[model samples]
Target chain A: MSKVRERTRSPEGDLPAPTPDAKQWVVYTQKREGAPFKWAGTVEAVDTELALQYAREHYGLDEACVGLITYEHGDSVDGEYSIGPLVPQKADGTDGDEWLVFTLAKRGGNHQTAGTVNAPDAATAINRGTAAFADGKACNIRVVLASDVHETTDEEMVIWRTHDMTYKLAKGYSKQVRSKWTRIRDNPAYEQYQKEDIETHF
Target chain B: MQNMLADQLANIVLMHADDKLMLGHIQSDWTGLAPILEEDIAASAMAQDDLSHALVLYEFLGERFKLDPDAIAFDRDPCDYRCCDLVTIPDEFDWATSVVKRWLTATFSQLGLHRLATMTEGDLGDRAKRLLDEQTIQVTHLNRWMTRLGRGSIESHDRMQAALDRLSSSAGMMFEPPDATLTEDESFCCGRDELFTEWAKGIGITLDAAGLSATITLPDRSTGGGRRGEHAPHFIDQHAELTEVRHSDPATSW
Candidate 1:
């Protein structure tokens, strides 16, 4: 047995008290230049910088995202989530700080960037955003201060590399792995393995 | 002189490849078990990046040496592997230790990759530049974790400090030459003193922000260690685990 395996593992005595959870931040990603940012997910982070970094590592690298934005969860005001498309309300106003608007197309779908509305506060921002972007197609309307929405700069746009990144993607290996498997196993066995892989692994 | 430079480059590349392979192997075990769900995904993704980066380096080495990349990665003898002891040490599933170790290594790797990227050699400079871009994500993520956990709470701060203290000794060994044949000038691809200075400056900024401190010094190159092909027992176990699948069916293709 190796020394590491043979050494008696000591019990971890008196584990430290758990720390409080970090603040939550919502993340959005843009697929390409001039593309609309879509809701990606949320991450727990201590601050905006950390949140954006986490988002880049988690959401930006998940696919081929070209841009990412994040805002503190507490900063955003979400309107009522309706079962059907929201009626275009007459809440037009342009009186204060700009708020970026995002609209949910369906109940379980992601929110996409709709545009921006000028309002004094979050509530007004949502109302004005709904008035501006909710074209009777959005299931929900959300608004956050444009200032609060931190974005990746040109230098920070290293989210996607120019190099071939297929190694991390399953599809990158699918064809090559399938060919290798076929060379070793029969067609039926290979097909069954591939099916199981898609069902179980994917 | 050219042959000597090539050997030194090969040695450095192998060291980095081995380090990534072991670190990725260990970290990948935490895929389903990280402290948080998002962290689990992020760590797993970074681990995948590490593994993929290792493959790229190995491919470069294979192209230079006329060998298969897979064989270069998995078929090496224990002494032929050049990963530092720091990467091979068991984190024992301790999140603080894992984060701290990765942060330290990532800082050093960023500097190393920067040097490699600047080289006039063939596609090596371009390849390292590509790897360096992805490596920025890992370093940034780890740096955030380090700072977050360090300033988080007393318990969190203490754990991070302890992890840094524990790994401080082994961390310097990353600067050791991977091959005995490498002269002082050849060992560091760039000058050792210059690399250490830049690396220390980068580490100092993160450590300062993280509210952490460690006494990480350059190890004496004359005193050989893991990069000199002398690995610890933990590395033996790690290598065994890493090669088990490859060894199971040496003739089979994955």
Candidate 2:
């Protein structure tokens, strides 16, 4: 409650510093249940669990959101990477892996989840992505294979394990806006208006 | 009797709006100062929801009372506003306290809205239901934080406990009946007894989930007349801040 200790503390001072293991996670939010999940934004969390919480706070709070899905940045491979056989002279130019495609139709627009295309590599997936989903307005497109995803179980989430670090979770900041409020409430103008206000009422 | 009921209902609605407006103002103060960046944005978003709800309620009141929404909100004197003492509690700069306060207030608001939704029919009922929809996110956000802090680190648990202790006395003020006259209408959707019982049960469930005790008792209605047009002792400060811009150079529009 004392202002001295609370006021001067630094931001993120109590929270644990991000370790080298922290990774960026891309989040997709579905505004309502059964609605299309749109690319919302990104969050930097040490793990998927923290990413979910941060993603909820960052993007989910502003609107009527129902669902959120996060993908680790490293788990995804771009379709552009497999551009070797652009014009595949032979029939065997494609691999058999099914790559999921996503498209960013406009600048600053959310990347809609496009359907998947079976291809030999990431580059072929990009071509298939363009052919299947492109409407001539796509600014960027990405593709990732299904096999690269590393899903963590609930019991494995490390976000809940920081028992020694209380400061990071909730104790780092102190705000004094109401201290001035207390003084302002005791002003004579307020006292004067209290009586006058009653008179104005019918 | 009908006229009295109308007056009492309008007053009750205004009190609801007043509570939301003051809470919105206080929470907005945490916009840039929250303990964490994500929390800062979340707090601002919740504050926006509170203000938005207040705006809707004020507009509803305007329709009934034949007053402009702006006048209803900004032109009122300090003692005329009917916001609860819990929303006016001074910022102790403690994150746990802020989150806990939000949790408790949001819980009470949710229950009140539930009772309202079930009690009234037609326009008032529709508005209550709509406001309840918007409150879903705030309730979820606050509940999660309450649980996390309650069961998180030892320091967090202790801080949360201390905040509960500090806030327990006035938190019950939120459940106080709007006004004695309002409850005289048999058609009214809910009574104070039902509201208090539902609120206590809901809050107990939430607190118990957060690893905290569920021992809240109602405060005396006489002492909690924010709903009766009796402002808290510290309400003038909030009124000063609220009216400062509008009152300054009253000749020009802000």
- Interface RMSD of every candidate? 5.2, 11.5
Interface DockQ of each model? 0.31, 0.10
Docking class of 2: incorrect
Itemize residue pairs with steric clashes in candidate 1: none
Worst 10 residues of 2 chain B by lDDT: B180-189
Q: Which numbered prediction scores highest in lDDT against the true structure?
A: 1
lDDT tens digits by residue: candidate 2, B171-198: 7777666665445233135556666787
Clashes of each: 0, 7
**Index of the highest-TM-score prediction:** 1
lDDT of 1 by residue, B22-88 (tens): 8888888777778877788779878988898899888888788777888888888787888998998
Instruction: DockQ for candidate 1, please give it.
Output: 0.31
Please give the CA lDDT of all the candidate structures: 0.83, 0.67
Q: Give the TM-score of candidate 1.
A: 0.85
Off by over 4 Å in 1: A1-15, A80-93, A106-108, A153-155, A161-163, A167-202, B1-6
True contacts kept of each: 0.39, 0.16
Off by over 4 Å in 2: A1-23, A29-40, A45-69, A81-100, A104-111, A116-202, B1-6, B119-122, B184-188, B220-223, B249-254
Give residue B99's lDDT in candidate 1 (0 to 100). Answer: 97
TM-score of chain A of each: 0.78, 0.54
